[model samples]
Target: MTTPLKLTEEYIFAHDLREASAKIYRASTKALLKHFRTTPIEEIDHRAVLAWRKKILENGLSKRSWNTYSNHLRTVWGYAIEHGLMTHTTINPFRKTSVVPPKRASKTINGEAIQRARNWLTSLVGQERCTQERTQITPAWFWLAVFEMFYYTGIRLNALLCLRYKDIDWDNKMILVRGETEKTHREFFLPIMEGLAPHLCRILGEAEKIGFSPDDQLFNVNRFSRHYHGKEMNIDQVESIYRKLTDKIGVRMTPHRFRHTLATDLMKQPERNIHLTKSLLNHSNIATTMNYIEVDYDHMRAVLHERSLAQGALSRVRRVDSSGTPPTSAITAPSAQIRLPSRKIADPKPTTLQPPQQQAAIEEVIIDRPSRSSGPSALRKALEFASAQLHSGSMESATDSPSDQIDQNLLLTLMASGLGVGTFRKRTQSERSMGSTSFSRASP
Candidate 1:
C-alpha cells in the first residue's frame, strides 16, 4: 500500500506549483507525516487529525498557522482520492476540522516612522561616504533606494529586491512587475512617483560606476558580502537589515508596513477615489484595500456639522423681511409670527355719510335698475372705466343709454363709501371736512 508521504510527493510533482508555494506545501506535509507516526494513508481518521490539531495548538501554534497545515493535508488527500492511492469511500479528515483565523492586526506605519527610517538611511549614506576608503559607493545607498521604492510603489519586498535595471522604463517613468515575481502571478505596471525618481537615478549612477550593466539587478549584495562578489540579496538578509534599522531608530516596523502606509496615505487624499487607491495598491479585491484604510470619524462628524451650520445660515437669510418681522412665506408660519396682508377691498370713492332721506333716494335709483347677477363685479368694472375716462380727460359718446346710467349709479355708490376716485379726484382735508357742500361743488 502506498504511504501518505509518497502520495504527497506524487501530488506535488503532478501539480507543478510555483517554487515558493511548493516549498510551503512540502514543509506543511512533512510536519503532518512526522505527526502520523507510520500510520497508513487510509487509516488516518478525523479523530486522529483532531488530536494532532490539539497537540499543535498546545505547542503554541496559532489557529491560523495550524490552518495552513490542515489546508495542505486536505489538498494532498484530494489528490490521493483522485489517483486511486486512497479509497473514494474514505472521508478527508481535514474537511471535518474548523479553524477560524484571528483578525489581522494593523500594520500601518505612520509618517513619523517613515521619516525616521529615511533619516537613519541618510545617516548611513553619510557614514559610508566619510569612512569608506574605496571610491565606489557602499550598500547604504542601495538600501535607501530600496526603502524609497517600497514607500512609493508599494510592491512586495521580494518583488522590489528582484527588480532588474531593464524592468524600468527611463523615458516613460514606469516600472514593470513581472508575473513570475509577483505574489498574484499576474503582471502589472506601476507609475514611478516623481519623489522616487531621483533616488532611482542615483542608484543607477552608482551601479554604472561599479561595472554594472543594464541586465544586472538594480540592487546587489556585493558590498555586504565579504568577498565583494556581486550576488542578489535574499529576502532574509534584506529583512535582517530592515529589522536592525527599525530597532535602532526605536520605530519598530516591518518592510510590509510600507505597503500598508502607501495604501492608507493615498486613500486619505481629498480628491482620491477608492477604486484608484485599490488599483494603486494592486489589490485584486477592493475589500482588501479597504482593510488598510483607517477613517477618521471625528473629521467626518465635523464636516456634517459644518454642513448643518451652512443650512441654518441659508434659512435665516430666507426669513429676513423689510419690516424686521418674520416672512409670511416661511415653512413654519406659527414659529416666525408672520402676518398676511388684509384681503378686504377698500371702497373706490370717499364721501361723508348722507342723511337718511337723501341716501334712500340714491339707493332707490341705483337698485331699481335691472339687476345683473354679477352685481359687485359689474359695478366695479363700470367705476374703473369712468375713472380711466376722468384721468385721460375724455368723455364718452353723447348718446344717453342704460350703460351710462349704470356708470352714474356706480359713481354714486362709491361716493357714499369712503374711497378716492383714482388720480383724477384730489380733495384737501378742508374740502373733505366741508361735507356735502364742498363735495357737490367739486364734482363736475
Candidate 2:
C-alpha cells in the first residue's frame, strides 16, 4: 500500500505541471503530509478528512485556502485510483466536503488612489533620472513602466514578467501571452493599446541598451538591481516594490487590483460590452470576468434617470404646445364621448317684477363624435389642434359659425379632461370669460 506522501509525489511527477503549478501543488499538500505522514492512501476516511480540515482552519488558514487544499488532495486521490495504487472501492475523502464561502469581497482600486500613486511614481522616476548616471536606466523607470502596463493592459503579473522582446508583434501591435505563464495554461494575444505603446517602446530601448536579446525577458532584474544582479525578477521581488510604494503613498496597491480596476472601468463605459471586456481580459468564461467588475451605481442611476417613464410623460405634455400634429398612426377612437347634461339658464328679472316673456332655455351639449384615445400621441394631437384654434383667434371671432364653435368646444373639453380635473375647471372659467360657451357635466 502506498503512503499519501508517496502518492502525491507520484501524482506530481505524472502530471508534469509547470514550475508555478507544481509549487502550488506541493504547498497545497504540505498540511496533508504533516497530518497523514506514512498512512496508507486507502485508509484516510471522510471523518479523518473533516478533522484535518478543522485543524487546518484552526491554524489560521482561510476557508478558501482549505478548499484549495481539499481540491488538490482529491485530485491526487483520483490519480491514485487511476494508477491502481488504490482499490476501486476507495472513496475520495473530499468528495462530499462543502466548500466554504469566501470571506472577502472582490474589490477594485479607487481611481483617485491610482492617480495619486501615479503622480508619486512620476516624481520618483524624474528624481531618479536626475541623480543616476545618464547611460543607465533607473529601477524607478522600470517600475513606472510596469505600473503603466498594469493599468493599461490588465495582464496578469506572471504573464507580464514572462514576456520577452520576441513576443511583441510590432507589425500587428499585439503582445503574445505564453501558455506556460498563464493560470489557465492556454496562450492568447492582447492588443497593445495606444496609451501603452510609448511605454513599451521606451522599455524595449532600455532592454536593448542593457544587451538583452529578443529571446531574453523583457523586464530583467539584473539590469537595475545590485542585490538581484545576475538573477531573474520573481513575483516576491515585484510584490516588495509594490509594498514599499504602498507604504510611501498610504494606499494598498497590488498588481491584481489593476486587473480589477481595468475590468470595472471598461464595464462602466457607455457601450458596456461585457463580451468585449471578457475578450480583453482573456477569460475563457465570461463568468470569471464578471467577478472582476465592480458595479457603477452612478452610471446606473444616470441611465435610470434618462429612461424614466415619468420624464417621458412630462416630455409628451410639453410636445402638446408644439405646432406639429401627432402622427396619424397614434389616432385611435376612444370608447366614450363627452355629453353635457341639460341645464336650465335663468332669464334676467324685469325691473317691474313682471313675469319673464320667454321661458328659461334648457340647453344640452352632446359631442357624439369619437373622442381621442388615451395614448400620449393622440392626446398630444388633440391639445395641439385646440391650441392652434385658440391662438389663431378663431374662437374669439364673432363671425365664427356655430358648428365651428361647437367643434372648438369639443376639442377644448377633450384636452382639459385628459390633462386633469383642475385643468378642466380652469379651462371652463377661461373659455366663459372669452365669451365661449361652457360644457356641462353629463348625468351618469
Candidate 3:
C-alpha cells in the first residue's frame, strides 16, 4: 500500500509548512531518489543522504533551502531511527551543519520611490494599454493603492492580495486584514494613509456603481492566476506584480523593498529623535530594523569631529596652575586665527562635595497631564512632568531616564507657558497641588 517515495511525500504534507518549506523537501526527495535509484529504505545510508545534500548545495540551492531540506531529511532519518526502520541512521548532517542566515528582502519604500511608483500607477489607471486586445486594467490608481497599503502599513503581499471589498471600512478609513487571510496568519488593522484614503473612497464609490458586493475583490488586475481559480491573486503572484510595477517605473524593487525603505527612512536622520522605525515597520527586533537602519559610522564620526573642532570641544584641555593660565606645550598652535578660551574657572563649590543625606530622600508628587506633547521629544516632557510632580521633593527617576535634563527643562518650559494663561494656570496649579507621590508609585 506504500512505497518509500510515497511515504516521503506523505511525510512532507504532514510536517512541513510555509509554501516554500514543502518544495525544499520535495526537491531533496527527488535528489535522493535520483542518487539511490533502486536502493531500499533500510539500505539507504548517511553517505547517500550526504551526497544528496551535497548535490543540492552544488546545484545552486540557497542555504536556507538546503538548510530546510537538511532539516526534513534529518526528520525522516530521525523517524526511521526512532521507529527502528533504519538502525544505522544517526544525527542529520544537514541539521548539524551551520545554517546560513536567509537573505531577507527589503520591506520598506523610500519617499522618492513611493512617489514615482504612485505617479506611474496614477497615469496607468483607466488608460488603454492595448487596442488590439481590447483590454486594460481597471485603473492604474488601483495598483498604486495596493502599493501604498504596503508602504504605509507593512502588510504582507499575501494579505494585501487577498483583500476583499469588506476588508476596508469606508466610514473609518481602516482596512481589516483578517488573520486567516494573512501570510503570518495574524489579522491587523491598517490606518489608511491620507493620500490613499480619497483614492480608495473613489475606487469603492466607482465600484458601487456596478453593484459590487462586499465579498468582491477590490482589484481585477491579472496578478494572481495560480491559486485563485483564475480570479484572485496569491502571495507570489502579488509579489510578481510589484516586481513588474517597479520595472515599469524603472526602480528595482520587490513588495518587501517598500517596507525596508520605509523603516530605514523613518530611523535614518540626524533629527529623527522619535525613532519609532521598528514599530512603524512592525518589526519584533531592534536588530532586524538595524539591518536597513545601519548608518555611515565613519562619515558620522568624521562630521562629529569636524563640528567638535569648530566648537573648540576637540582641543585638548591645557594643564594650568590655579590662577587659570595655559602652560606652554611642545605642540605649536596652528596658523589659523583660532584662539583658545581662557583657562577653566573652577566652580565656587568643591567638585568632590556630596549632596546632603536629606536631599537624597525619595519624594513624589502627582499632577494632571494637560495636552500631551507630540514632538520628537514629546514623550520625555509628558513623562518627566508627570514624574516631577509626583516627586515634588525629587524622589526617584523615570523607569527609562530618556535625556533627563532635556525632559526636565522642557517640562519647566511647559509649566511656565501654562502659567501665562489664566484658564490653564488654574488647571496647572490644581494638578501640581495634588499630594506628592501621585506620579511615582511605591516600588515593589
Candidate 4:
C-alpha cells in the first residue's frame, strides 16, 4: 500500500546508484504494472515478472537496460525481505533467473564504401551555394573527425567525445583517455593513425585559434542536443550532420559503419600484425577481434587467379595469335602432370636435324643452379618462402618447371574454377559463397 511519491523517495535513499535504479523501478512496478491485470506487489509472481521482462525485451530494449531493471527490482525485493515487509517464503522472482539476451545484429562496411564516406566528408569543407555567402559550417567536420578518431584509435564514442586537448600527444601521435569513459574503466594510451594526422591537426589548429587551454575540451561540439540554452552535441545531432552530407555526396555511411570498415580494412593486408590490430581495437580477447575481422578479399581473388592459371582455364590470345595468317587461336598452357620415361638426353638418341632455333628450344639448359642444404635452417627458409608467396599473391611463373607440389593459392583457385580438390571435389563450391548481407530493410 505504498504511494509512488513515498516509495520512490524511500527506496532511492537505500540504493547506491539511486538515480538510474529509481527510473527502472518506476518503469517496472508503476508503468508496467498499469499495462497488466496484476495489481499488487504481493500478488505479482515470478511468471508475471518474467512476462514483463519478455514484453520489454520483445519491444527491443537493450541488455544494459534489462540489467538495470532486474538489478533495481532485486534491490527492492531484498529491501522488503530485510525489513520483514514480506515473508521469507515470498520468493524473490528474479534472483536465479538467467536472462539470455538475443545477440545484437552487426553491420558490414567494405573499404571502398569507407573511402566514399571519407571523400564526402572532405567535400563538406570549403563549399558555397546560392548567394555569395559561405556554405553552412555544420557539425560534419566534427562528426568526420570523430569518426576518424573512432576507427583509427578504436576508442569508444563516449571516450572519444570526452577527449580534452591535454589528453593528446601529437608528437608521439598518442592520446591518454580516462578509464571512466572506457567500457572497461581501464584507460590506455592509443596511437593516432598517420593517415588521419592531417585531419586531427586541423582540429588542433582550430582549437588553438580559439585559444583553448590544455585542460579544456579540444572542440566546441555537441550543440545538436542536450544544451537547450545555445547548443550541445549528441549522437542524433552528429548523425544528422553526417546523413545530410552523405545524401548530398551520395555516400552510404553512419558512424558505426567506420568501425566495421576498419576491421575489414585491417584484414586486407596479409602483412598486418594481429597483435597490433588487437591492441588498436582494445579487445580483451583475440577471439573477439577475430569475430570483427574478415578474410581478405584480395587474398581470395589471388587464390581464384592461381586456380585459373593452373587449370589452364584462360589463355591470352594476342593480335598475332588471332590473325588468320597461319595461327592457332590458343597456345596450349602446360599441364603440371606431363610424365615421361626417365630416359636422359645424354643416354644417346637417334638424332634428326632441325632448324638451329628449333634445336635451341628442344635443348634443356640447367644454368647456375643453387646448392641445396638438408639443414633445419634451409628447410625453415624454404617453408617461409612458400608461405610468403602463397599468402602475398606472388605466384611462380606459369612457364617455369612445375615443382613437386602446387601452390595452395593455385589449389584454391583451381577448386573455384572447377578443379576437383582433395575434400571439396565439386568445383566452384566455395567461390559461390560471397559472404552474407548483415541487415535488410523492413517495410515502413
Q: In candidate 3, what residue range of length 10 has the lowest lDDT sum?
A: 435-444
lDDT of 1 by residue, 1-444 (tens): 677668778887996466788777888888887888788766678888999999989999989889888888788887787777787446777896868878877677878878887887788788878887432224677778878888888888777777887888879999988777766777788898888999889877776677676677776766343535646767776787778777777876777888887777786678758788777777788988888786656667978988977766433344345655543332222112222322221332332222232222222223223233445666566556544434332233334432223334445545444333321222323233432111121111
Model 4 alpha-carbon drift over 4 Å, by segment: 1-45, 53-92, 95-106, 128-133, 136-144, 222-232, 249-252, 267-278, 283-444
| Predicted structure 2: lDDT | 0.68
Judged by TM-score relative to the true structure, which candidate is superior, 1 or 2? Answer: 2
For model 1, what is the C-alpha lDDT against the true structure? 0.65
CA lDDT, candidate 2, residue 119: 81
List residue ranges in candidate 1 displaced over 4 A: 82-85, 130-138, 223-230, 271-274, 290-444
TM-score of each: 0.62, 0.68, 0.54, 0.51
In order, candidate lDDTs are 0.65, 0.68, 0.54, 0.54
Q: Stretches of candidate 3 above 4 Å error?
A: 1-24, 36-50, 59-64, 71-90, 98-110, 125-138, 222-230, 234-244, 269-313, 316-444
Better of 1 and 3 by TM-score: 1
Superposition TM-score, candidate 3 onto the true structure: 0.54
For residue 106, model 4's alpha carbon misses the true position, in angstroms, by 4.1
lDDT of 2 at 97: 65
Query: lDDT tens string, model 2, 1-444?
Result: 567667788998897577877777788777787888876655678888998888878888788888888888889888888778877446778786656666466567888888888887787778877876422224667778898989998999988889988998978999999887887778899988897888788888777777888788887766755645656778887888889768876878889988998999999887889998887788889999988888888988877877775555333321121435433222212222233322232322211111121111112223343334445565557555654444444335455442344444544546464632111222232233344444432221
2 or 4, which is superior by TM-score? Answer: 2
Per residue, candidate 4 scores C-alpha lDDT tens digits across 291-329 of 777666668899899998887565432223233344322
Model 3 per-residue lDDT tens digits across residues 1-444: 333566566666565355555676677677667767787765555566666667767888788766765677767656655655544446543456536767665444446776786766665653534332222233355556666776777666666666787888877878887766643445567778896787678667766776678888776444321223555545665666667766766677776676666656555566664337654554456776678653546658888989888976634443334554564222222211112223222333312212232222223222433334334355455445654553442334434332232224433554454321111111222123332111111111
